[model samples]
Target chain A: MSRLPPLVPGFVAAGLVVGIIGASLGALFVVGSGADGSILGDPYVRRIVVFTLWQAGLSAVLAVGLAIPVARALARRRFPGRTALLHLFGLPLVLPVIVAVFGIVLVFGGHGWINQALDRLSLGPLGSLYGLQGILLAHVFFNLPLAVRALLLALATVPGESWRLAAQLGMAPAQVFRFVEWPVLRQALPGIATLVFFLCFTSFAAVLTLGGGPAATVLEVAIYQALRLDFDLGRAGSLAIAQLAICGLVAAGLLGLGRSVAVTPELGRATARPDVRRGVGALGDGLAIAIAAALVALPLAALVARGLTGPLSTVLRDPAIWSAAGRSLAVGVSAAALALAVACGLAVATRELRLTYRVRHLATAPDMVAALPLATSVLALGAGLFALLHRVVAVFDVALILVAGINALFVLPYAMRLIAPRMLHVAEAYGPLCASLGISGWNRLRLVEWPSLRAPVGLALALGAALAAGDLGAVALFGTQDTATLPLLLYQRMASYRMEEAAVIALLLMAIAGALFIVLERGIGGREHP
Target chain B: MSTLDLQAVGFRYEDMTMTFTLRVPAGGITALIGPSGAGKTTLLNLIAGFERPVSGRVLIDGVDMAGRAPADRPVTMLFQEHNLFPHLTAADNVGLGIHPGLRLAAPERARVDEALDEIGLAGLGRRLPGQLSGGERQRVALARSLVRRRPILLLDEPFAALGPGLRRDMLALVDRLRRAQGLTVLMVSHDPGDARRIAERTAFVHSGHILAEGPTADVLGPGATPEVADYLGEHV
Candidate 1:
């Protein structure tokens, strides 16, 4: 009789709790109807659904479509600043949405430098930079890097051995994609598309700032107005339910697609020389690099220049700016810690449960957490929590809890997404060995799992922290005259037309977020000698 | 006493409904030679207590160990890829078998040193597994089993990656270890030469069933099934 490995009941219990929480939240959309026609009768609800779907679809298509050519160029060619360019793609993964939006606005807004230059050249100041176009443009800006990363990662997976084989077979560039690259890209497409679509659908800050009017409003924006502006509980509840249904369906589809697709290994080690060497191909490659660089670099450069020329020094002197910066730091640290805890719990749970039904259900928690913050506006969440608990709780106390909760919720998906792959890899490769060694419970985690996951875990933490620090969403709802975050303060300065002050704060925010990410990533990940 | 016994032991993979059964005598090296997809590794996993058989019993020293975990079952497995903990030193990898956690006291270090010396790795205890060559890693794995002193040692193509010279040296070491410790060895190999070199008994398995089992010489000799003969390359 072979001995059965001892099951850790704690991990199982944690899984059960996460499962219950996700199911109950999902059920809330089904059972309750407060104002928007008992979850089924609201015509306004239909519009919200269509708007959300449209924006997400358009954004994902544009981002990924543009990314393909850029990825191919990157994969083939060697250039100065290529490594820096690769790292640039990772910036948006950690960059705060609000900060990125602010950067976009500086370049594209009516009175912004782009329009100013156009006006000087007698181009008549190209039409209004608001509504559907603005939101779609911002979405593309935010997600283009993500799409590039996913596509490049896929392109990298094409083995050099396969490339050598293709060369030996005298395959052309078209033939290479037809056989070698197409299959990998096809395999990676669903995952990349799903991730981008989910990101766009849940987009809160971008929609709120860029959507020109009511006709262009997304579901998350409606949820916010229903709660914060009107204080209408029923309408807010209905919107929440509607948001849940749409996000749930999309998430389920994504999960199903993700399961069917097998993850391919990364392509052979990167080569310094260009893969393509022909006339038209060379021109196309050059154009792709030039466009990708301009698209990412222009706004970033404008923001930095604006900071140098504007009220950076005055903003630095303001105690409010310093306090808000401090608050942002605190929130970021707390959110990162909370996100890590939840991610670890989910990972351990997924490992312990053998039943497919239970595993699939728990797997959705991280996705939900990631997408929910984007789907349901931060203002709406703050309003919902306040309404639910305000009868017994102090407003200020609830405000801080809401801030931390939103930040944690917003960052949870990235942590889970980052950690899940690494954890699964470790489990697939090492679980049997650990089980055979009777290395169960915390001992197994500390000795076997932790060592392998150290790099990914550190990266996840850095990303979560940076996102939290840069977040401008919940701050609008919970931030008081006294408790503003750096982004909130920047917005306040911008609102008062203190353009100089806002510019400085923007630069400082980017610097802090970037610096923190670098320090943490290097400190933890550097421990691995190789 | 017989070191290991299997009573009607059977295993079936969940993905497919095929079943495999096997039994082996104690003390000598029992080689399970088979084509791919023949459930050779499954049989090894079952005996090492890494996987539980769907039905029947496994006994070590006449005691039923059906519910015993791998660590508690007096069995050790050496894998093909050498799953040495990369962070730990070579001696520490061997030391894990005896202490499980490599938490050795003063006297245990001497025992570890002696085990390392016995495996011809005497002074190389402090080097990490990454620093060791392929042959050295396998020797460390062998030393690990020695330190554990487990009656049953399961080898899953542990020598498949080594050069011919090192493979022979390791086989000689395995023979010496079996003689010195009376360890009951069950090894899975595709190479007929490996089976003939070390195993006393060989089992020819195909399609999840043991087609034949007997002394190594007989199994590889005349009148064997054409599949077995082809597998052994009798024409060569």
Candidate 2:
């Protein structure tokens, strides 16, 4: 009897992922068990924990609360550049966290645009843009757009028939919202809230920069401090465990909610919302959309303006900045390559189980492996790996490798999401035809699958590269003075109050990410449709 | 050409346990007609080695086809849609039949052109599937199947997506190919008119069983079985 080869590549990759995660967790437990409880009981540690929960909860509430009107306005209106505005909302997700924060500082800081405007008006300038308010502002800036996109998706799912009925019945704006939109929006609310909370809970670069001092520290920054600032492995280990436990619980809740945050919103359905055409309601929607657009656009605008205006020629000549940029480029390309390989294997295995073997439940096993880094925070994973490797090798020697590897795993879920749907479609549509035609293995991949899969695979690679290029999470834990990436270099500049140089670096990093996205997507993807 | 036989071949799909037994004499067109979800397609899949039966055996020319993969089996099939890869040109898609890699020597390349000529698609081999009409796409698939030259050809409603006039033209083309190549044809179709047009033998498949079998005139005539009449009634 002829037998298909055991899905060796896919299974081996999956097993390796599981083994790495298992070893990381095992090392964490071992180190954590040896640690004393004194660190957990410290007043500063307790404050950090409380502040972490407070900030995440407040961020989730504020982001979602503000997103409702914006999403509603977008749902009802059909203006020019509406699609462009929605696309702009997707920028915060791929934009480097530190760059956005630097932009926030430029716009809202003491000597920033707002304060300058206040000074010119002879109204006293605001006192500060630090502490809780600054942290909240940055968090909301990142997450409000995310919330708006998610809510926009929910609003799009409101069947067109409901809108038609509302118009026929002459339902008022408030009545249409209550009768038609509320039910669908409420159902989608919890999942978006949980996702936003989880993101804010594990936030690293944003809080690390805007968090003025210890009073506003989150657990991720605390882990960095405990590990790097004090050289206290015990404290770091315990804090890492604590953060993992909380994040795991939140992630479990997210899974129970049965929604993965969508990175790209589906094409918005054009429902004819005729209830609020040109009354006060129309004016209100326009205002809501205008404010949300400015909120998302201003920081990015400030980043570009400051970047072009500040020491561009000198920063371009600095060798340290160039070396850091080179290191970041290396890490990003390596991470993208590794991530695409693993995502392909997992996607192939998943299609085999789902289509050929017909075991729907078992197909999700590979997906679970891909999603492992999500449940376990990236910093925790890094600290655990550091502990595991410290006894055998110098951690500094393998910093780039560790950072790239973890970032690959960190981006694996997104890569898989992008590739798996298209890969399965290619297999399902052509499997039997290929089978009857004696097309299998390399022939099938080259002739049948490659033509259909290249576009999505290129997109996956591009996104992975951009996300990894600007990553500061795992690199912060593993980086030394000699091994600093661009984001790390930018962070150091910010910490030491070299605001001018930092702006230049932030702009450079942003440009690198954008260029990587375009190059990989276009160079590999070939064309939009093909 | 080959004689195809199913000897009490059994399959379990979800809660349904289907057992089918049938035979088609060599070098003739045999059509299996039934209501939707009546195991007609499953029967074709079993014979083409696309599906494995739970019990008994499928024999081609009296040899048990049990341990052969679909590719190794002496059969070819054309699905309802996606018969050609969207990216591949017509010539390359047909060339796959001669050698899976399209590594054609002079004579092998000539065979692809000849098959395309037979299917009336000559000189259009450079066009991709997206550039072809619905009828042209199915003809291209027929051309590929002709080049494969398998003794048995299974058509799983290959022309169902076409309009009536186009479907009949495709059926006439299949009839000509079958006669010219001396191929055994087992076709699954929903329309009884498909059987009336070219199929000499017809089998009524119902509830995973061959409910009736005979000449097409006798089976589909006015004095048919009650179940067959009822099924035909629904279509009308």
Candidate 3:
């Protein structure tokens, strides 16, 4: 343990993280070499970058800004269905992007429920839900819930003592918010904003689904156009570099976030919040909560309504849908298993290395393993691997393996985040005893480490499975007629204007994804705390 | 049993630096007493191979422990708490000492049983650590060290979590186990009464230096070093 710095596991973990970055970089180099450097002069590329940044920045700002009031309202008012509402807010993170996109379309599309209602009102069908407006709507739909939950957690962590003191001093709600609640939200803002921005920045399915024409094209869509439509690998490479440069700057900006505020005992949120509701305050909070609920709930409700209105039996009879659903299951399992193993190994190795060495430089490697995927759009990652593999094997021949591998890489960061803290905690608490007892290698892991790791392992597996099952980024790029995943199948159905069949396929996809998450999440033990 | 040696050992954490050079006879109980943040625990970690000293040798029976990992070294330590895995039964936790993977044969199981009985936890071996009291957990930790059979044992404030009576009782148990196992021991205790109870020699550490070392009585007596006298103020 001491002599060699736990090189075997350390290298494996670092290699997993570095290899993905390298593969993406290798793709960049391969493609960029053939680049004519004509991107700046091209109007289409210009519009792509402009729309990409515009939509992403707007989505992040709007999501986080709107989440503040929703979180604050939820924090103060406890109701019958509050916990259920909280859980509902977590749904979008696990839902397939295509399903959510279709849901947005159902609520806001040209012939959707909203437009039909407007038609009856003689409002002339209120414009189409395809372009910047629809793209932003879809982004906000997917991310608002995430931002709300993040802010809500931060709000909950505000020391109850502060609330007590605020009440004692007879502070108004606005004053209380300014003096007390604002700090916690401000501290959490950077991390939450960065996460939402990256998610929207790398968005794939919604961009192509809602965003039509060059004016609405994003960088990811541009890369797809280059690689899949035009067969221009060189242009895709140059666009990837551009995307990578922006991501690098964003990551650098986020470096200061870690040191900002750690959840501390001084926060001391052990006590309950003091009730300070009065007349207007209660009404305002009520209004805020209702609006947020409607904003998040309407699209999902529309999705369900529209999905059930279709010829369900016809969609069920489609063999392609069944084949793709089965394929998605297999790919998700493979991805989750691979991600879990890599994340577990990295957590162990980082903890071990922390013990033997004082250089914390190695610590960030595990986190970076997952972060790389977020920074590089899934389109870039898939194109990189696809280009390199296209040299040896037909791209579709190893589609399942490639999808699983890339999926694992994508989720590795999250798994690392979920599991690494517990691993370090176990090491800190038991490292001395384990070392003194001559416990090392597999024996230590089996006897001392495994007990505390069960919950985190369960979490990692479930998260990986659910996320991979819903993922359409890389799948959309690499999928062919024979190798389509569930999301891709749904997209294909929608492309053919078979809205009824697409809705049915969306329901089935949601069912399978949700079931996979619940079963694996509960399968390991009595309860999972993550 | 083997003698413990810290020859010209120097280590630092952040701005704190500590240097040590001492030898203790085999199979004896030596207590480390110190002021707060005086590197008492860090010294124990160095001895247990949790950390390496900057410029010296950690020799166990004259063999340089240069490249040996904490697990490879011949030592066992009892922490203040977190001594037992909550997920493991008491028997399995103690069994881990005999074999890392708990691949205990019939004879090894007997030995684990014997160790449990010796710690007055014979029937409670089937229970988890969480089911036991504070004193019972410490006993379980001792039982683990007993089964480990390492020539040297280190204790880092192991009894700090227990009440006075329990602490005294556990110190007595350590003395008894030391005599039975012929184990060389260095235990960290902040209370002078604890050093008075079990230790033969007392090492007074302050500001990262061994300010005083002798028989426990002489070190804590009237004519002690001024630093030791000040540390063991009127309270002691």
Tell me the interface RMSD of every candidate, in Å.
20.8, 24.5, 22.8
Clashing pairs for predicted structure model 3, backbone only: A370-A413
Instruction: State which candidate, 2 or 3, has the greater TM-score.
Output: 2
Measured with C-alpha atoms, the lDDT of residue A518 in candidate 1 is 74
Which digits, one per residue and each the tens of the lDDT, describe model 2 over residues B1-236?
A: 89999899999877888999998999999999988888987887788665779998999999999966565778888777767655568987788777654568999888889988999999999999899999998898898888877889889898998999999999999999999999999998889899988999999999999988888887888868888889788322
What is the docking quality class of candidate 2? incorrect
Error of 2 at B200 (Å): 45
Cα-based lDDT for every prediction = 0.72, 0.84, 0.79
Candidate 2 yields a Cα-based lDDT of 0.84
- The DockQ values of the predictions, listed in order, are 0.01, 0.01, 0.01
Sliding window of 10 residues with minimal summed lDDT for model 1 chain A: A259-268
Number of the top-ranking candidate, with lDDT as the measure: 2
Q: Which residue ranges in model 3 land beyond 4 Å of their true spot?
A: A1-5, A120-124, A259-275, A433-448, B1-236
Predicted structure with the largest TM-score when compared to the true one = 2
Lowest lDDT block of 10, candidate 2 chain A? A161-170
- Tens-digit lDDT string for candidate 2 (A129-227): 888888889889998989998888888876654464344233467766765677678888899999999989999998898888988989999888878
Provide candidate 2's TM-score on chain A: 0.95
